[model samples]
Target: MFQTEYEFTLPMGYIDADGNLHRDGVMRLATGADEIVPLKDPRVQSNPAYLIVILLSRVVIRLGALEMINPKVIESLFAADLAYLQDLYNRINGNGTRSLKLVCPHCQQGIEVELDQPGES
Candidate 1:
């Protein structure tokens, strides 16, 4: 069976109220409702970027010792960490993978490469 959720480790990590660090977490595949309803949110309406925050908050079921997860918590993540999460989301939900490693037939060298998305110039 295909996996519906994936685990990731944050680079900077999230700090809880008592000073605990939360690096590991799980994010489930977003449902249709998850993506659509957030559009109605005033915050999302005012700022499209906030849509990721709200969507992630809904799908991220757990994060280390945190008792609850919410948009505020997702908003508090560092920019790099947040970008990492976004990449992870795209990798899992968009095409099931990001990059591939292959050996050059002529040079016998191995390299990792990412496929360009559609509409890229």
Candidate 2:
């Protein structure tokens, strides 16, 4: 079966107003509309970086116990967590890959390695 959603854990986690911490979450592949619609938003119009917040809110289906995920929620995330989500989004949305290519410092040989999220076994 084809998979469209991915699971992730924030590096620092999101803390709610009640002092609850949310670490685990789910993000789905982004659709064209997800990328396009946010462009029309005043926030995105004024600050292009705001696009990531809007874009993420649209694709992230779940986040711990939160009943809803929105741009405000995303804005509240720690910088590290927000970066994690961005990388995850790019990987699952066909904008990035799991493998990274590198050249050995000593041997000057090229090699490719697969990347694993922090907690994955």
Highest TM-score, which number? 2
Which ten-residue region of model 2 has the weakest summed lDDT?
Answer: 112-121
Q: Can you give the TM-score per candidate against the true fold?
A: 0.79, 0.84
For model 1, the superposed segments whose C-alpha errors exceed 4 Å read 95-98, 101-121
The true-structure Cα RMSD of candidate 2 reads 4.9
> Model 1 — TM-score against the truth?
0.79
Would you give me the overall lDDT of model 2?
0.91
Error of 2 at 61 (Å): 0.8
TM-score result, candidate 2: 0.84
Q: What does each candidate score in C-alpha RMSD?
A: 5.7, 4.9
lDDT of 1 by residue, 1-121 (tens): 5678789999999987788899999988778898899999999999998998998888888888787899999998889878888877777667456578999999989999886443333
